[model samples]
Target: MRSHHLLPLLLLCILFLAQCTKEEDTSPAENLMQEASKISYTYPALSTEPMQKASTLTAAEWNDLANWQLWTPQLKLGAGRLVQEKWHFALQHRYTVVLTDSLHKRITDARITLETSQGTLLDESRTDNNGVSYLFLTAPTKPEDLRLKIVYADQVFYIGDLNPQNGRIEKQLNIQRNVSPVMDILFVANTSLATADKLVYLQKELKEIINKTKSQSDSTLHIRLGSIFYGLHAGNSVIRTHPFILQPEPTLLTFTKPYTTVTHSPETIDLALEEAIYRQAWAKNASSRLLFLLLDTPFLQDPGTITRLSSLSREAARQGIRIIPVSMGSMNLSGELLLRSLAIRTNGTYIFVTHPEEGLSNPLSTISTYTDEPLNNLMLRLLVKYSKLN
Candidate 1:
């Protein structure tokens, strides 16, 4: 009942509060999943409301960033049950994710199967809204490969050899979702000397995709190919060259060296696009022409440039030219948002190249052939869609 007794009691309460705060700061689950894992969430904006969002953030940031909410799910006793269960099993494994569409939104009801590096099935699970599913194996384990198969509707995604002996536990899986056939495609490259390496790589890759598609289809598919090459201020301050149609072939034939480079100067994508409006050979062939732009920088950002770009986008949309812009280079999300806007506005695909051979919607590049199966599947899907619309 004295002042001394009250002081000791107050000190004890302060210490208790500090302990609680420290616990909240770092739990085992948080520690496991909080390793700053970067994930890309690409959804067409709910509206045209001008706002900025992070394209790269921690795994913790992803939960809150999904819908622009500032809240994350509170940690619970079962927060990382999958993590805990793995320790008990000899053949331990945990969360696997399923992403659908080019937007990479999580597929809620996808079926996931865990298997050994060999041909044995370990267990099965399904994804929630977060596209995460967990698995447990009661059998004894060996130091072999680990793999997963995710099936949704007609889509089948396979990610195998996920855990080698030296692999990390907290893993993020990326699988390409190749849709049905597509229309005749035109792949454009900006070959300004600065981005010349990227352009060279793109041309070689695009040619391979064309060749692969031809080999798969016994010359049954009818495909038309258009190729466009623009350089520093290409088509601007001079004449224009939007779509250069390749020769007719049994299968859709893509062009290699469809164009010859005149000069290497600063890239003027605005001028390149303006010429695209008049690229009738490609646009007239199909109602909605499919053009893929691989570039090292965003379009020029001046008033005249912006005006030309806006006009080009509108015209392209009207003439059935959907611009699929692939943003390369090391530009951050803020800078790359310009490319995103072009995709959204034209109702096309916006893909930011997170790595040399990943996070690609089209998933076709020179360095990797991971797209062979899926790309073939998508080509067929597009044919059906394009035929129906035409």
Candidate 2:
């Protein structure tokens, strides 16, 4: 009888111990997946169409095509230069015009050309609904008398100070760009532990953007640099005193005290937009207005918060403020989804600074992917997205 009782007790203890071991083995990753799952929502209402291109648009326009108001009619903006044998450019519009009849039909098959002052044609292209594409080129020889001409059937139009619109064209044409151009950008970053090293890498990259744009000869991302570090680790979080104009911090910023914090939430982001951002007059009008977010939190976590985030995103889009998010550390489903949602809603881009352990890309790309050099890809995308490069 004693042996039987003792055997049952022993087996029960063994079973409990096995259960504990299983839970211990799965806790960390399981928790991550659970959080990610909570945010794995499919928002069918969100627009996935390409944004209305202005006179200038990058090859990579963040996939939002509805709701927001993009600057009039450009796809890509900025400038290009011929350095050595290669011609590099961000592709800003020098002049733009929409061809339409009284019936409001877009002239899709029209021919557009740019010519030298001496009537020599330089570049000729066709038009889509958005308008004709005209890019500025920094040739080795800075020749004067560069002019533009448009021909639709028998109608002829010249773009210059003295030239007027062709009788066939419907609207008055001018060289119009975006309301807020990304040439001058404001960066907001999370100062969490996982983002510490990543922040350093980004700061270096930011310097590259600043240097490239600052050249009087070269144009794009050329603005006075500024950053606002947000999170628990940030010491007394200082908002910029003079709008988005802070001297670029040279040293790599590190907040190495690991405390797995959630700094990127809807409230925090909304506050940043209200105080740190929208206070500027340019918030309403610039050629390319862009906001770069470096963080682990893509957006809000809870449903209530996410709803608020949607409103904020729409407002940002209305103001032409594109919110580009770059996430660091372990990629979770929730963060990725929310981030992509924010970008799409605001007509922006989402950059994933993912580390590969299993080393594979999620089919949706909202989840993490294993990359050899994530930064290089990020930089290229940034150039294409923020610089509006073709």
Candidate 3:
């Protein structure tokens, strides 16, 4: 009788122990995934059909079919000849026009081109009177440093900050040739054949432009940005989404992309993580400024991933690091709840991304407002808060 009772008790204890061990083992990885999800997200609802129509243009009359507001400046922390080995960029604009006559039928063949210091390239298109226009580019390795320019019709649009020193095209070429660490761009093509054609065309144009600018040196990255999950080809636009995120610490921004695809490998993750940590370390020791983490929400759902990120957050907190999670989720309530929980747990801020276009522009507003405040007042407030934390 005694043996029988002990056997049952021992089995029950073993079962409980096994369960606890499983949870403990997954906890770390789960946290990582959660944090990553909070850093990235997906919103299928934002998807709409691409526009395809002919342009109404006389041979002599030029039309500016692409929109330019969506472009953002991509800056780097490196000094000497720097190259963005492989970066992705996304350029979005809406193209629409009023009908000059009743029942107007005009082919608005709209296309987007990327102009770098090295050269000019064309990309995917949606031709319509008024609709969203998106373009992607992968820079060539030849030009060490360059400025990316957007061209539509006869006029060239300047998206980045640099101005053309010589002739616009010549100045751009010079920059691309002179830069040291070369840059190569990876492109994620969209699902449509039209989109792929657009990207291919852009690459071809870029090759010609590069050849005209200067000479090739190093090979850049296979891709700069990619979907966290799948079904999307890596593209320049995706990589360019968070240009500031790649900067060195004291000013580094973090991002989690939704939709993982084959192009996104362990190597890329490791590189990005290392860069971020290095920046954080620099800021902590040098400027004494707190590091801010910018996380996208929808991407942080899988429990396994969350566990891993949670452990990292704990570690960061232990070292007096501050993480700010910017929730950019366009999912339903369930997804929102999961993201919010992670943000709250990490002691970070969460902002739901209802519209990609809106969310992308909102950051600028926030930054601008903060910049206008008096520095002394801001410093005093921060110092007071730090004292309280101590």
Compared with the true structure, what per-residue lDDT tens digits does model 3 show for residues 1-390? 000011334335544554566453433223222222222111111112211221110001001111011111111211100112211111111112111112233212222333455455433232222212222333322223433443334334344433333212221111111111211111212222212322333333333323322222123211111111112336321222223222123212122233334322221121232233332322222111133322232343344444444444434332323333332222333333333333322222233222222122222111111111111222222222222210
Candidate 1 residue spans exceeding 4 A from truth: 1-182, 214-220, 233-266, 283-288, 332-335, 355-390
lDDT string for model 2 (113-166, tens) is 657767775555444323323223334223346555766555687764323242
- Best-matching candidate per TM-score: 2
Worst 10 residues of 1 by lDDT: 56-65
Name the candidate, 2 or 3, with the larger lDDT value.
Answer: 2
Query: Clashes in each model (backbone N, CA, C under 3 Å)?
Result: 12, 24, 72
Candidate 1 residue lDDT tens string, 1-390: 001011334335544554566554554333322221222232222221211222221000011112211111111222222212321211122233434544555444355676777757766644432343444444445544667776656566667656543222233335443322234566666654445544444433444445544544434444556656665333444332434444444233323331324433435676667655564465233223466766655444555655566557645544445577765544333224345445533435544444343232221111111111122223333333333311
TM-score of each: 0.41, 0.46, 0.24
Model 1 residue 276 lDDT score: 56
The weakest ten consecutive residues by lDDT in model 2 span 76-85
RMSD (Cα, Å) for all candidates, in order, is 21.0, 19.9, 25.4
lDDT of 1 at 112: 66
lDDT of each: 0.42, 0.42, 0.25
